[model samples]
Target chain A: MSPPAALRAAGLVKSYRRGRAVDGVDLTVALGERVALLGPNGAGKTTTLLMCLGAVTPDAGTVEILGHRLPRERSHALARVGFTAGYLPLPERMRVVEYLRLYARLAGLRRPDVAARAALDRFGVSHLARAMGTELSSGQKTLVGIAKAVLHRPALLVLDEPTASLDPDVALRVRTGLREISAELGTALLVTSHNMVEVERLCERVVFLSAGQVVANGTPAQIIDRYGHDDLEGVFLHLS
Target chain B: MPTIEVYHGAAASFWRVMAIARRHAYVLQRSPHRLFDIIVWPVVDVILFGTIGVFAAGRLGGAGQVALYLLVGVVLWHVVYQAQISLATGFLEETWSRTVLSLLVTPMREWEYVAGVALFGLVKLLGGVGAVALIAWAAYAFKITTLGWGLIPVAALLLAVGWAIALFVIGLVLRFGSGAEALAWGILFVVMPLSGTFYPVSALPAVLRPIGTLLPTTHAFAAGRAFAQGAATPWHELGLAAAGTAVMLALGFGYVVWMLRVFRARGFVTRYS
Candidate 1:
């Protein structure tokens, strides 16, 4: 009847010799809904994100992306999912345009060059397209990474500390673009960031992961009220 | 902007693989080191080795057949080396650039990435191998065409083993990260003597002869020598070479795929640095 959620990850678990990295974590994001996965360092936020994207296969769990089972139908699922992280750097040898075009084509865009340029323009960084990967400032690199992530208009867009390096104004601009994509293209946004205020501004829901488990999940207002916190930052501090 | 349709089926996958190739093509075009690795270095190798081959032939009472044998062997070895290095280095480039996670996130399958780069590997070495072949002829007057129909199997067997080495190196990288990076560049040298590129398996030490004979490239080279000597096609050796290639290929592809699973399970896929 209704379209399946953009992402549905249930009882996702992954372990290493160091012990369990993700412990039976479950998450769901509706189509076009904006959600944030927030956690402290070593809290397994990135691991959960990777599992959702099929980059990391969980030892125990089922991840259905855009209604397609992960690893089995990864090609079908990931075709509609785009992911980016500031920690995952761009190729040093590639120009920004070429880098964006590569991801665009990989996402199945027929006119990848046009889409790449448009994405850059959307983020007001069209001039950086010719810049070599090493030449970009940290903030500029993150901006280009976001541009690359959104170029394909993926059904579910995942970002990891995406705007960590951007100036406030640039961050606001990028956030606005993200909102526009979700509204116009129904591109569900699943993001992880430390900027609590920006998270409040951008995401409709917040998921707090602590020690590889969901400690809290609800709307920002609901979570704040339930935790009796002044803001999302207070709740995050309490969780930590 | 034109409406960009979300693609499906084989056609979309084909283009996605091409995008992988296109990215590599751009890197090759822009990076001086890559261009040198694929082109200039091979030319220099050809010149240096071709000269030695010519001197050796001269030393053998002006017997040009010896020159042809040495020259052909040199050319084939370089071709296989270039072929093997292309795939391994193409993969290592992603790790070096810290972009493996970004790559894995897309719709492109792992096999597609390997296939695209492997195909590019062919393109990358063609110019270099061709250049060496030409130099072997121009400097030594020894044409590879002299090997006749036998050349096809020799080249195919060598390339198969080359691809096998690449898969093995890639598996090592996926399993051990950059710590095993040396394997990507150096594994083939370990396989070189066992392959008998310039010498017969019988010439190896007894301990190595057994290992040498186990290699497809060894048999391939032995068959090539028979052709050079105007002997009939060495069907027995040729058969052994083809069968060995089949087994190595299966093991290679299987091992890499397994290593990828291990990598993903360890959550190292996106931990790229």
Candidate 2:
């Protein structure tokens, strides 16, 4: 039997008065599958992710996370999902450990200290645990943000531009961490990034979005083959 | 079973919010200079105003009477101003640090987030009020003994008004970006002189009185002054104030909801490119 889909959105329609941002988009991700959402700047990839996370409501469509609808049943859905975004940083006044502990508790961890420490260690930033969030470098902040999201070991992880500002070495560490988390916890991963090579290296499948629509969806190699491109970057540039 | 699950989840969310509040409070505690600034600014203003009144007693009202009046106005005005500005600045800090979007994606609803910010604002306002009241009592034996209980209702009204103003400003912040801070400051400066903070609304120029009446701060100041003087508050006027505050809050919240919709629709979430 196929594993249950960790997240599913059907006929998702989100529009502004001026134009549609996401036009009748449909997407699904099974447990433990790593899917990369690839799109240009205004392709509505983040809108789709925000809708799935229940941060933004779709004008028309249904979204289910772990088989639970959003906004109405969001508490149940969000409890099982973890998310990170380049646009959303942690509170600057908060210490790394304090912020992690707070989110860990929110994510339903009983002993938040242990969970926070473990997450920090996993990302190899335990030394910076007591530092203020504002004091950290961009790469260090990204690691802590990711640690905060995954402290409860969520079954579904949604990350947006997770490695956008990181050094290549730190980005590789994060990539390794994402793969390890998916493997160990059987967590489905849906991530959006500008780094096509990172997506090619880390994701099992890729979904290409253009002008608020999913223009292509398939395995990385299959998408490359279908688009007649040398690699994921070539395909992304062609579609974008 | 579903009910029990919801209960557990709500309890958990409440604890999480409380935890964030506690962390924030801890940070405030560590930064004693910030706390000192809140308290010290009011004291310095009181002294400066009191001195001016004393020196110009013949030109102004009786020195003692004018000092007492200004004390009430300054203390109450400070609370309203502090509450509004602090809440906006707090949210601005979150936006600057990119944490508002982070919290939005959590299980927390928009209402809960607003509640948390309002709660923090309330704490800050109360602290400032308490410090000012204490200093006034110590220095001048100032007492609003008969009107003490009225402070509660006045504070509640002012808090609602402040939160409403903050919400409207937050919508602008989310839409126009950090430039909203300058707008907020400008609005506050324009509103303060007309708010009857230093004098009665009757003292304003005939044309300005109508403008003053349009502000919630005018009603808040009237309510607070009545409470300070132990005057019988006109319930009709109090009701009108409350109603006006409620309308502002409702409109502010509605505006925020609409702005969020617009932000989503416009793809602001992914417009970094």
Candidate 3:
């Protein structure tokens, strides 16, 4: 089968009155590829991700998701994408099953219940499906958040700091699930996280952003080698 | 198949908002204290003001007249209070739970989101108003003889005005964070005393009449009282009030739309950092 671009952004520029938050950045991801966005605080990582999801508009740029332009025609584009952010949580008062089913329906799933349960089982959180969202621990909440994002089986997945608060074991389980999702569904995965080890292990490619600009772009190994670091963390510290 | 798909898409958006509202209502159900606070607070205000009217009957008006007047003011005030508090608190709650960012990423537009929240607020306000009106009617024989079909339009206008005020408050909250809550309450206090809510505008000092006329609630109360008293409403005043309400609503909605643009531009939607 011929490869298709799952996501593409060109000349993405977003600015506040004081200064630019994301400055003329460009990026692309192909189906079945797992890309990690690496950056320190104030690096415009989240801004880039929000722009891709059409949650924020760019002052100057073009974002095409699965061949659909963003912001101007985001409804069609978003229907084919799923997103999660570290700061955004599920409604705590809602039951896991209720929240997931609601999002599944919103994602246009025909069988929301089955799809929601399948996602929960995929993440090994099936037992918590009936529990209230507020009752879940931090790690459990993160897992549920990821499950909700993927339940729709979108062509693209964007996760912002997806595993920031998880313990090692839960984080590993999440990574494994993400890998399976990409391999099985050919979904393009673009994720941002501060965990360099996880990025190095899961991502085939890495993009390093610093102060609202792209500073590095290559494979994890290649980027690390060019920065003359043994690991992604060392490379991050060197650049940041 | 394409038509079915389109229908499904629209239904999904509707259901998403309904789900949010349902979950919120459920949480509110669990917090009986909050429910009681909203429902009972207005009732207490009516009783307190009613008693004060009774003691000052010689100075103000008769017990029945004072109760009739205060009941209209209290009910209308409750509507405004409920609408403003719900709008501000609902957005704040979403922000606190980080759910607003999640919703922003969805296919729903900003107008649709605001409409859904406003509808929810309207339902809650109407329920509170109904309960208070029922109680006052039973206890004090608060007769509303001319409260015919005409009252429906007045109520609808009042609801729209309340929602508009709430939207303005929501914009303030978004701009200044939780500190805006204090400002909102302070503004309400200032308006309540000056708007001829508890007493007639005629009783107001000559200097304050213009200030009272500027308030939309002043017109709402006057219209409501006229309906209750079986008197011909001053259509000119009502028309002017409706125009003022429309203007306020347009300005309030405009400010909210502007604020959302600012929030999106600044990446405040995901600015948890």
True contacts kept of each: 0.86, 0.37, 0.47
- Would you give the TM-score of chain B in model 1? 0.93
What does DockQ give for each predicted structure? 0.75, 0.36, 0.46
Model 1 chain A poorest ten-residue lDDT run: A84-93
Span of ten consecutive residues with least summed lDDT in model 3 chain B = B1-10
**Tens-digit lDDT track for model 1 on A146-205?**
888888888899999988867998789879989988988999999999999999999999
The fraction of reference A/B contacts recovered in model 2 reads: 0.37
Question: What is residue A153's positional error in candidate 3, in angstroms?
Answer: 1.6
lDDT of 3 at B95: 66
Report lDDT (Cα) of residue A9, candidate 3: 93
Tell me the lDDT of model 1 at A42: 82
Ranking by lDDT, best first? Answer: 1, 2, 3
| Candidate 1, B60-104: lDDT as tens digits | 786565566567677788767888999899898888888888888
lDDT of each: 0.86, 0.78, 0.77
Choose 2 or 3, whichever is better by lDDT.
2
Tell me the TM-score of model 2. Answer: 0.85
lDDT of 3 by residue, A110-189 (tens): 67788888899999999998999889898898899989888877789999999997889999998999999888888889
